[model samples]
Target: MNIRKRYLTLILIVAIALGAVGTYVGLSVFAEDTSLNNSGFANSDPDLIAELADQQENIEENMGKMSKVVDAFSIIQENYVEEVEDTQLIEGAIQGMLGSLEDPYSVYMDQETMKQFNEQIESSFEGIGAEVSMKEGNVTIVAPIKDSPAEEAGLKPNDQILSVDGESVEGLDLYEAVNKIRGEKGSTVVLEVNRPGVEDPLEVEITRDSIPLETVYADTKEKNGKLIGVIELTSFSENTANDFEKELSQLEEQGIEGLVIDVRGNPGGLLPEVEQILKNFIPKDTPYIQIEDPSGKKTRYFSKIEKAKGYPIVTLINEGSASASEILSAALNEALDYEIVGETSFGKGTVQQTVSMGDGSTIKITRFKWLTPDGNSIHEVGVKPTIEQKMPDYYYTNPVQVEEPLTLDQSDSKIENVQIMLEGLGYEPGRTDGYFNEATKSAVEAFQQDQETEVTGKVDEKTAELLQTAIIEKVQEGEDDLQLEKAVETLTK
Candidate 1:
C-alpha cells in the first residue's frame, strides 16, 4: 500500500464497488469531460439508475467522505504521473488506499483475488485453505482454514510471514504476498512466520491442496441454565439457503427452542447466501436493506426474513465479523428483534460488484451502501450489539489508554475521572482515594503524557474526556442485553 495516510478501508472498496470500470472519473465542478457524459449513468435503464441512486444516498448517510472519492479518482486518472494499465492502475489505487487505512477488514480484490473469494464462499476451491493475511506490515496467519493445506502446514493465527521460498517478502503488497503463497495444488509454498510471544519470525512450508468450503453448522449448548441451540456459521457460502433448511430440520428434530448464532471472527462470504440466511429469521417480504444516493432516492432490498417455527434468538458477533456478517445481523436485528452479544462488529457495510473486462483482468467497484431495514446505515459506524461484550485482553489491541492520567495534571476533571475508570476496570487505584495523590497522579500522568496532554497533575474536563476511554469497556461488560435476557428467562411464563 503506497498510502499517504490511512483513509477508511470501506471507502476504497466502495469506490470500486460503485464504478471501477470505464475510467477514473474524477469529480469536477462542471462537466469538464462533456464528451464522456459526466452525468454518469444518466442513460442507463431505470432499474439500474434506481439502484445507483440508492447506493449514493446510503454512502452519504454512513461515510461522509465518499462524495469526494469519485472526484479524486477522476482527476487522478486524467493526470497520473506515469501511464499504467487502466485495470492495474485502478486495482493498485484501491489496494494502495485500503492498505493505508490499516483496517484489516477493508480490502480490494482483483479478478484472481475476487474469484478466490467467491470460490471460498461457494465452499469449494482447489488450493491450500489457510486464512492468510498481513499484519504490522508482514504477512500473518489469521487462522488456518479448518482442514486446509495451511492448517495442515501447521500454521496458526498471528503467525507472521517473513519470507517465501527464502525470498524476503518484508515490504510487499498484499496481492504480492498472496501471489507468492498461492499456487497450483500439490505445489509447495514455504513461509517464515513470527508467532506471538516468539522473539522472531520463523520458517514453515506447505504443499498446496484442494480446499473445500462448507456452511451452516449446528450444535447445542447450555446458557442461562437452559439447553440452548447454537448455530456456528463459518461463511455465507453458496447453497447456504439449502444448508440452512437442513439445519432448521435438524433443530426441529432436536426440538430446539432458543437460538444462539456465533458469527465471531467471520469475514464475509456470499451475499445471496447471507440474504437467504437472514431470510430464515427475518420477516418475509421485508426490506432487509435500504440504500440511498446523494439525492435521497431510495432502493430497498427485501429479505426473506421469516421467523422459522418458534425460537428465541440471539446472534453473536465480534471484531472479525464483517460484510456478510453485517448483512446477516442487519436482517435479524430488523426482522426478529433479536439481541446481539459480543464486540462492535467490523464495519463493512458497502456493496462490492466485480465487472469483468475484455481482458483477463477485472474491476471491483463500490456500488451501494447497505442499510438496515430501519434505515440505519452501517458503513463507518458498525452495528453495535444489543448486548455489548467485554472481551478479555486476548481479544483486542488497546491503542489509546482508556483513561490518560490528568494530562494537564492541573487541568479539569480529567485525572479524577481516569482514576475512577481505572477503579471501574478493577485496576486498583491509590485507594478509592479521590485525591490525585502520587498513585492517582501517576495513572493520570501516564495517560496525559502518552496523549501529549499537559502534565499538570490536576483532574479537569480533558481528564473527564479521557476517562471516557472506559466507555466501550463498560458497554462490553454486558450492558446491552439486560432487558432481553430478562424477557427470555421468563419465556416459560
Candidate 2:
C-alpha cells in the first residue's frame, strides 16, 4: 500500500510539474500540438487546465492514442501466427520508429543494442567491426575498425555497405546496419561492399571478433625542418577523449612544435567527446556552444577543464570534417588563434537529442543550434580556413576537370576554382584547376549567361569576382559560421 501510494504521489508531482512548465511557456493546452495549429497561450485556472486535459486534449490525446497501440500489440501477441517474444517485437517497433525519424545517429537501444553501443564508444565491439558512416544517403564504412574483422577482410574507407547477410542496407541507418553486422563471436557476417574504383559489389565474409576502435591516431614527424605531430582523429567516440589526452602528453614529452590535427572524415560521435577535446585548447570558463530548446531556453557549454598546455597548432579540415571535427576546429581557430587549413568543413551545427517514448519507440529531434566560443553560428557557415591550401598535387591522380569549350583542363587553377564555384551552386564540374579548359569554359559561359554577361567561352577577372561574391553571400546568410557556435546566454537568468 505504501509503495503504491508513493508511486501515485510521484506521478501526480510529475504531472503537476509538466503542466506548470507548459503553462509557463504559454503552450496552449486547448490547441493542436502542430506548430501551425498552436494558439501560443494556455487558459488560466487549474480546473480549466484539468478540464482541457480531461477532454482528451493535446498530450492526453497522444497518450490515449498510444494506449490503443499497446492494446493492439497485446492482442496481437496473444493471438499471433507464431509464438513471438515480447522483447523481439518491442525491439522491432523501436527500430521502426528510429527508421521513421530518418536520423542515423538516433536509435532506441534494447539491452543488447545498449551493450553494443557502449562497446562502440569504449573502442571495442564484437562481430565484423566496421566504422559505419553515411555518405550520399548510403550507410558506408569510413574505415573498418582498425585490426578488426572488417579490416582483416580488407574493408576500406569509402566502401558503401550495400547489404548485410543478403539484406539490402538501402533504408537501414548506421544503428540498424550495425545491429545487423554484429553477432556472436566466431559467427560469419557477410557484407556486400560497393567499393569505389571497383567494378563489382564485392562480398566479404568476416568472422565476428572484438574490434578495437582507436579514435585518435597521432604520429610525430619532422616536416620542413620542424618537429610536427600529425594527429588523425577518426571520430569523437568516448574513447577518443582519453586517446587525445595521451597524445597531448606524448606531444609534451617530444617538445611540441607544430601540430597538424587531421579530422578529414570524422563523423561526430558524442558531443561530450568534442567538449573534452576542446578543453585542451579552450580556456577555462570559456564558452563552447549554446543549446536552445523549443521554448527558446538557452544553455551554454563552457570549457570546464583548464586548457591543454601546447604550442603552435594547425588544424587540417576537409569536406568530410564534420560535427565534432568542426566543433574542435572552430574552438581552436576562434579561441586559440590556431591556423585552420584545407577545405571547407561539413556544416552540421544542430544538436540532436533522443527520447524513449515508453511504448518501445523513440523520438530523435533537432534540439538546439550550436554557436562557437565567440557566439558565432557554426552550422551552414563552416569555419573558413585562415590559409587556403588547395589539395596537394600528389593527391590528385587523374583528377577530373570541368569540360569547357576551347579550354585546357581542370589542372588549370582558375578552371578548378570555377568548378568549385559551380559545385557550390548545385552544378557539376569535373575539376577545380585554374586553366581555361573545355569544362571550365563551358561552366564559365553558362555562369556568365546566368549573370547577364556576354556568353564568352572564357573566365575573365569579372567572373572570378562574381564567384567570390557568391561565396560571401552564402556565408552571410545565417549559416552559423561563428568560427564555432557558443552562446552568450543573453539576459537568461
Candidate 3:
C-alpha cells in the first residue's frame, strides 16, 4: 500500500450514532491530483480570482466589525479580573469563529488535538483503538478496530461509556471523552460500559498499547455441505487493498463455492482504497463511484480491472456502514449484480477536505457530495440494501421494574423472580423466596459478574433485562436465529 493511502484513511472516520439521527463523519480527498499539502484551490481560474477580489472588498467593508472585536479583546486584556493566556484567547477565538458557522462537523483542533487527529488516521496509534461517537447523548463505541486493544478488551459497538477511571462521562464532549481514554503506551484505563442488550454496566479494564488498524478478516463456513467464504471488512485502511488481495487468494485456494462480504459496522476509509477493492469485483468500464462538485458538474470514477471469476456474492451492511462502505455495496450491486443484505446504511453523502495549516492546526470542512454509479445521491439518504432485514430483537420483552436498587436484607416479592431466573441460569440465587437475603445478594453479584454488569448485587434495569433475556434464551434455544439462517441459506442455495 502507498503512503498516500494512509493520508486518505482520515476520510469518513467520524461516525457517531446521534439520538434519532446519526451523523457519519467521512474524509474526502476531492481530486486524485490534489495533494495533501496543497489546498486544491484553482488559482488560475478567472472566476475564482474575481470571487477572491469580491471577498477582499467585503473584508474591507467589514473592517469596522473586526475593529470592535479587537477593541473588546484589548479591554479584556487590560482590565480583566484574571490574567488570560494569549494562546487561550487565540484558540478560543478560532473556536468561536468555527462554532458560529453552526456546523458541528467544522472544528478547530489545537496542537495536541491535531496531533491526535493525525495519529488516528495513521496505521497505528497508542490508545484503545476504538472509534467512538456521541450517541443518544452518551459516549458510545462505534466500532473497535480489528486486532486492537479495544477489541481485545471486548469493547463492542453501541457500548456506552458510563465512566472513565471512576469519573462519570455522562455530559463529557466526544473529544474530551476520547482524550480521557487515550494515554501513554502500556498504561491502563478502566471503563464502565453500558451495552445495549445487556441490562447493567460492565467494568472493562484495558491496557493501552500501540493499536494496529487491521481491517480485513476472512473465514470459511460449511453450510449444507457447501463451502462459503466470509470476508469481514471493518474499515478501509491504508493496507486494506493488500490485506484484501491476500484474503481473496486464500479464499480462492479454499475452493469456495460462494462468498459473503460483510461490512456491517464499517465506518469507511479512503475512497481510493475502496475503489481498488471494488476493482477486484467490478469490470474496467463500470462506473465505480460518482463525485459531483458544487457547480453540479459530475465526474465518474471507474475500476481499472475486470470482474473476477463468476461467483455468487452477497454483501452485508447496516446503519453503521457509511461512505466508502456504501460505495462498495453500491458498486457491487450496480456492476456485478450482487445482493446486499442487512439494514439501511449510515447515509453520509458529503465529502470532507482535511486542511492542514502551517502552524500544525487543522480544519476539516465539507467539500463535495457523493453519488452511486447510477447517479443516485446518498447524502443523508443511505444505500438501501436489496434484502432489508433488521437484526432479530433479543431484548427482554418482559418488563421488570425496580424503582430502587434491590440489595440484601430488603424484603420484596421481586427478589423471588430474580432468584428463580438465576437458578434457572445456574447462578444459584438461593431458595426462590420473596425476601432479599445475603444468599440472594451473593447470587445476584455472581450473576452480575458473569454477565459483565456492575456487581451492585442489586437489580437495576440493565440487570433485570439480562436476567430475563438469559431465561428466555434458555427456554428458546436453537430459535430466533433468522439473520444467520438467511445468510446460510443464501450462500448454500
Candidate 4:
C-alpha cells in the first residue's frame, strides 16, 4: 500500500477534548493548501515535488523493513486462540507506532472520537466545560472555563483525574477518559480527582450542561479615581477577537484612562484569534511571536499596527493561564514593555497539527515550537510576571470534605484548611496549624452564629457546605482580589 495515500489533510494544532468545550494550551493552525493530490503536491511547486519524491523513496525503503510488523499482524490474526477484528489490529498497530514517539500531545483519534471533535468545533456540546491535558501519564485539568460547571464545582487547575463515575482511568488515553466524562445535558458525572498538596482524593460531582461560545467578558473598575477598563478572556475561540474588539471599543467610548487585560484562568484556543487580538496592541516595529519548525528554521510574525494604545495596559495572569494566553502576555511584556502582574503562567510552547488518515480517523502530532518575541521558549518554564502577586492563602486551600464533625483538638489537613478559610473570612483562627485549638473553636462558633447556623464549635457537614459557599461567593464578588488591586495600583502609580 502507498503510505502517502493514507494522509488526506492537515488540521489544527490545538487538541480539543471530546468531553470539553474548548482546547487546552496550544495554537490551532489549519494547513489546507498543503494537502497532496493524486499526482502529489497540490501547488505543483518543483521544490515540493522533489521533496515528495525523496519522501516516497524513503517510505518505500522503510516499508521493506516493516516486513516484521506485517508478519506479527498476520500471526496475531490467523494463529491466535480466538478471532480478532482486523480494525482492532490496525488501530492497535497505529497506536503502538504513536506510543513509540513518547509524546503525549501526539495521539490517535478513532472515527467516533474524530466525529465528536468535529461536532464540538461547529457547535457547543454537553460536558463539564473544562480543558484538560495528559501530564506525566495522568489526565490533568488545565483550566475550567469561566462560568462552567467544572469551575462552579470548585475544580482547579492541575487537578488530576483518577477515575470517572467509579471506574478507574489508569490506563485510558486522554480522549478515552474524556469520552467517559462526556454525557448528555443535566446528567451528573462524578469525578475522583487527586489534587496536589491534598493527601486524599476528593470526589467532585458535576452536572453536564451546554457550554456557550461567549469567551470574552468586559467591564470597568474605578480605581484611585481613574476609570480602568477590564476585559477578561476565557479562551481564544473563533469569534473571541471580534468580541474583544467590540468590547474594547465600547470601553474606549466610555473614556477609560487605563486598561487591564485579564487572562487568569484562560486555557487558550485558536491561533489566528490570538494573533488578530495581538495585532491591535503590538506595534509593527517588533515581532509578536516566532514559530520554529522541526528543522530549526524560525519564522517571525509581526503586527501591522504602527502605534501602541494611548493608555497604559496591565496584563493579569496566573498558573491557569496557558498557550495563547502566554503568547499574549509575553508579547505585551517583551515587545511593548507592558507590566504583567500575578503568578507565573502554565508553560506550553509547542504546536500540534492533526493529519487525517482518510478513514474518518486522525492523528495529532507535535510539529513545531513557539517562541516569544524575544526568542525565548516558555515550554517547561512558564512566563514570569513583571510584578509577581499571589492570591490569599485560603484561595489555594482545598475544599472541606467532612465525613465527621471536626471538633476541638482534632488534628487533620481538613482542619488546617478550615482554619485558613476561617481566618480569611475575618474570624480570628489563632493558629493555622493542623491541631485545632480553643481559638479555632471560638472562631468557628462566631462564624456559625454569623451564618445563623447552630452555635456548635465544630465543622460538620452543614458548616463545611456553608463555609465553602461563603468563600465561593466572596471570590466571585471580586472584593478581595488583591491581584486586580495590584494591577490597578500599578496603572495608577
Task: Give the TM-score of each candidate.
Answer: 0.55, 0.57, 0.68, 0.89
Off by over 4 Å in 1: 1-118, 131-144, 149-163, 166-172, 184-207, 222-227, 284-286, 292-298, 304-309, 377-384, 388-493
Q: lDDT by residue for model 1 over 349-380, one digit each (tens)? A: 77665554433345455556677888887775
**For candidate 3, lDDT tens digit of each residue in 48-109?**
44654565455444544455455555567778999987567756665677656654446666
Candidate 2 lDDT by residue in tens digits, 366-464: 667777777777775677777666542322221122234335442454355467666665454555554555665667677778888777766565665
Candidate 2 accuracy as lDDT: 0.62
> What global local distance difference test value does model 4 have?
0.83
User: Cα miss at 37, model 4 (Å)?
Assistant: 9.4
Model 3 lDDT on a 0 to 1 scale: 0.71
Top lDDT model: 4
Better of 3 and 4 by TM-score: 4
Sorted by lDDT (best first), the order is 4, 3, 2, 1
The C-alpha stretches of model 4 lying farther than 4 A from their native spots are: 1-54, 119-122, 449-454
lDDT of each: 0.60, 0.62, 0.71, 0.83
For residues 1-493, could you state the per-residue lDDT of candidate 4 as single tens digits? 3332222111110111221111211111123434445543345345545654565455545555556666676678779999999778877877888878877778999988888766554457679999888888999999998888988888999999999999999988889999999888899999999999899999888999998768889999897789999999998887889999999999999999999999999988777888999999989989999999999999999889899999989999998999899999998999989999999998989887776665568888888989999999999788899999999887887778888899989899899999999988999989998889999999999999999999999999899988987877677677679899899999988
Q: Cα miss at 148, model 1 (Å)?
A: 3.6
Colliding residue pairs in candidate 3:
11-27, 12-26, 12-27, 14-25, 199-462, 199-463, 200-462
Candidate 4 residue-pair clash tally:
1
Model 3 — TM-score against the truth? 0.68
Cα lDDT, model 3, residue 60: 40
CA RMSD per model (angstroms): 15.3, 15.9, 10.3, 5.6
